[model samples]
Target: MNTIVSTYNLSKYFNGICRVNEVNLTVYEGDIYGFLGPNGAGKSTTLKMLLGLIKPTKGNMVIFSKNFNKNRQLILSQTGSLIESPSYYEHLTGLENMRILQRLRNVSNKKVQEALHIVRLEKQQNKLVKHYSLGMKQRLGIAMALINFPKLLILDEPTNGLDPNGIREIRELIKSLPQRYGITVLISTHLLSEIEQIATSVGIINDGNLLFQGSMEQLKAKNKAYISIKTQDNNLAKKILLTEGYKFKQNNDRLIFEDLTDSHIAYLNKLFIGQSIDVIRIEEHRKSLEDIFLELTGKERSL
Candidate 1:
């Protein structure tokens, strides 16, 4: 796949404080790239630099294989963005709002209609923006971005305040964009579960530092699996495991074996039973995306 966007050591500083530090990012054509980080993790700052909304304090960026500084307009022409919140003329009808944006982008009215339809807002296109729900407004923001048929879409926290159903709608819309419109997307969010489901690749950032960046499969592969065994006599189980040279850790009433395989589990179960340890339960567990996120970013909340 061709790299549609690439940043080399991109850095952004505010008042002598590093908001984005030596960050490198890659987004390929036809990819749904998830930019994930906790709150204040430089996600927005990096995106601002990428969109030319702000200048980078250090390093540089390349979009469509052209230098960002020299080709700002050319790069932005092919990119559509909805950073932070969606803005609209609340009194104007959705169709009217779209028409205004269409005029600004010099795109055809047909493109406006097509964008509204893509976001599933065609039925409500004539309704006043003030009557639209928050979710609808967000969808409309995306519609505005799509009015010009941009090759790349950058959305920051697009699902910030939607209900579950609204989130699902936006999620499905974003997932389909790359294939349906042939547009690459760079979406930043604190929602790890959403990323795990829809993103082809992920980049994790924390405190202005890039901790992890890779395909979803590669990220999941980093989620370590373990055999968790509970027993009637935990102390006895631990003693047996130790004597048998099985490496493990104890958590409350359970023992966690990180390097255990299926065979090891079976053998351990049999051995415990033979030693009268009275196994209560044994199950395999793997870290969820949220678990991995917390571990990597060292943050408790999803923000």
Candidate 2:
């Protein structure tokens, strides 16, 4: 778990406002680190600084133990990134674009072919990039990133415009990168389920501050056992459930219990029956990544 990247008091300011505060973080080897936040939460800004696309107004940034300013070429050679929407030469064939990128990086032609194969774009190598579908274009962008055979891959919303099938394909591809190619990944996205499915660890940010950072199991453990109790008298069930010292919230016609042990739930069932409440159903709910995000980020939607 050696550090692949580290930041000390990193801050990015635009027009005298700090978009990225004095944030410190570390990324370990072979990790699929999820950077989660809302649309304007400085996630992309922080990544730009990490990739040296934008300079930090304060503090220092390091990649693979090399300071970004002094050793950028050395560090960037082993790093690949696709930030926001990737643009490619529309008229150039996929293979031609790859060849151009390889020549620019001084990577070999064989490496170019290998990268195309890795992203499953070899079959369409002769097709012009503009003719490719949204998913195909995204795959080609990924192949371009892989051409360098980077030790670290940084992607900003890698699956943004992908279909469900496209999303699953990229999901599988990303999950295989660390173990198969010995590459570490830093991915940012607003999609919680995508991160939950693939990321080994996560860092949640809001208003330029780190809200939570840990393994998936640790984040899931933050909330107590969730139970969904459905009854015809929804209001009564909610009132009774809350009165019994069980913290609960209302979801449609159901009462969502935040913390309730088995015995307490059983007693609740008995009490509801005695009170002439017809119980429709009682089921335990699994707290999803969205639930964890909302809990950590204060249960509010922010633009």
Candidate 3:
């Protein structure tokens, strides 16, 4: 796939404090790239730099295969972003609000209508902004961003304060953008479950550092499988495992070890029975994506 955006050693410092430190981000065309992190983990700062809303203290960015600094105007003309919250006139109708942006971007009224429809706000376009629900407000923000029919869209924590139903609506709209409008999306959020559902690629950040970045399958594969066994005597099992050159963790009466194949499991069962050790039960478990996300982010609970 074509590279839509790439950053090298991107760093942002505020008042001599590093908010984003030596981070590299890669966004490909047709990808819903999920920038996952805890709150205050520099996600917003990094995105602001990408949009040129703030300058990076050091490092470089390339957008659409052009140097972003050299081609700022051209890049931004094709890029749309809703960083933080979008401002709107509460008394104005959604359609009127969209028209203001249409005039600003010099786009036709058709683009405005198309954006509102894509966000499923066509029916609510004539309603006053104050009458719109939280979900409708967010969709209006997105509609404003899409008024220019941008090729790349960046959203910073768009689902920040929505309920379950609202979240689902936004999630569906984001997931459909790539296929429907050929737009590449870079969305930052604290919710891993939402990322797991909507993102084709993932970037995990914490403490102003980028910890992991890869495809969703790669992140999911980081979860390791383990075998937990209960025996009549766990101490004996530990000793036997140690004597047999195996590593394990013990908790109370249970012994846990890394994943063993079916053949290895059979061998262990036969060996234990031959040694007159009565086995209780052995169960396999895999670490969840949430667990890995927490471990990587040091239990920062923005999610």
TM-score of each: 0.92, 0.83, 0.95
- Model 3: lDDT equals 0.92
lDDT of 2 by residue, 95-167 (tens): 9999889888999988999889888999999999999989889889999988989999999999997899999
Better of 2 and 3 by lDDT: 3
**Taking the candidates one at a time, how many backbone clashes does each contain?**
1, 0, 0
Which segments of candidate 3 are over 4 A away from where they belong?
242-252
TM-score of candidate 2 to 2 decimals: 0.83
Residue 32's lDDT in candidate 1: 97
RMSD of each: 2.0, 4.0, 1.5
Q: How far is candidate 3 from the true structure (C-alpha RMSD, Å)?
A: 1.5
Clashes of 2: 0
Q: Which regions of candidate 1 deviate over 4 angstroms?
A: 231-245
* Cα lDDT listed for each candidate: 0.92, 0.87, 0.92
